[model samples]
Target: MAVPLLGEHLLFTLRSPRLPTHAGQVSFPGGVVEPGEGVVEAALREAEEEVGLKGVEPLGFLSPTYSPQGFLVQPVVVFREDLPPLKPNPEEVAEILLAPLGELLEVEPWSEVRLGRIVWHFPWRGVDIWGVTGNILKAFLEVWREGKSPPHELL
Candidate 1:
């Protein structure tokens, strides 16, 4: 999930040391959906749990992507009127980074592995964002740039 603040910045989290997977990596505040839970519900719940984020209004959802680990991730875009004082849960988050959307938009993919495969990396502060999280940001920016609504296939 991406949280857009009033300053045109987006929120990202550094994974906690306690996490089994992707520890210390940069990611959005989200996790696996539990049984019987919808994607939006799960995203909201995880955001609240991991970052104490509240009062956000959902803008839309980007196209879902499958992780290399085989989990389907639905990226939700949300808006906040202003930046909130975040209380990150130490067990799930190490630090919160607010990146300017303009900088993110200006970033070119760091590498192109194949004809259709491009690899992106965004380094904010000292942390690098890549892999699935990077892909999510790239897709979201594309949709935003085109001024098109998020794909209806998202749910």
Candidate 2:
């Protein structure tokens, strides 16, 4: 028998007062791809290193995306058999916020908010989740809604 997979993807927010590159905003658990690492491996490794999630089994790869910084990114869709309670690394993550995929899909188009030089939304939290990570999530949700795959670069 195939084990049932949870339909909702966990949307976590990093809690760090000092803004690294995209600081003081909401984002997924990911970062720069390391040397000689594939996209999925990088994602899983980042997840483990930043959020203390080890041995996460990646289900599939979505698509290759280019970050605003010019490096190519791959969003890995993964599942952890048992999500050990999150222990965020202070240097990378401060807090872990769990967002249900269903809620994100059901959410209305985010009400726009402007922060410094950028514009996005704090639709879920009072925090703005923008940048490349936000784009990836938006694209993923779009594909989930359309019932057909969309090109990664579209987002």
Candidate 3:
């Protein structure tokens, strides 16, 4: 998965309700790696395909993330200083969201027990970010919690 950061905001996609899985839910842009493509390549490609994002530079990679559905997803960080116009692919994306990274980092997510496991929900605006996407964001925040800088060259 590619987490596109524009300055201090993170880019997210609202999945189209017509989709089969995770429909109408918010998540980062990502898809399966192609025949000879690497994780970073797949991430950038998926970002472009799903949200019309282009020319972003990869910043770093986080630990592999696994969804409750048992899919292994590699998370990659990408960034662009200036805000870029985003066009959502109507078939896959309903809307594009820009989340305030500072607010997300400052607020603690609420949690609940679900299926014998603790699930966290990060509230933003009027929406709740949970499930796989929530887990990914939570893990990413761990870096800051540990007082470790993210794999970045420059903002």
Against the true structure, whose lDDT is highest? 3
Best-to-worst order by lDDT is 3, 1, 2
Task: Work out the TM-score per prediction.
Answer: 0.84, 0.73, 0.89
Candidate 3 C-alpha error for residue 63, in Å: 1.0
| Per-residue accuracy of model 1 over 1-155 as CA lDDT, tens digit each | 54434347788888988899999988888887889988877888889899898888777787887655656788887777678888899998998888887888777656444334454676655667776788788777777678653323222
In candidate 3, what are the lDDT values of residues 83-139, reduced to their tens digit? Answer: 888899999999999987778898669877655555668989888888778877887
User: Candidate 3, which segments miss by more than 4 Å at Cα?
Assistant: 113-118, 145-155
For model 2, state the Cα shift of residue 126 in Å: 2.0
Q: Candidate 3 has what TM-score? A: 0.89
Q: Which ten residues in a row have the lowest lDDT in candidate 1?
A: 146-155
The CA lDDT of each predicted structure is 0.74, 0.59, 0.83
Q: Which sections of candidate 1 miss by over 4 Å?
A: 1-7, 112-119, 148-155
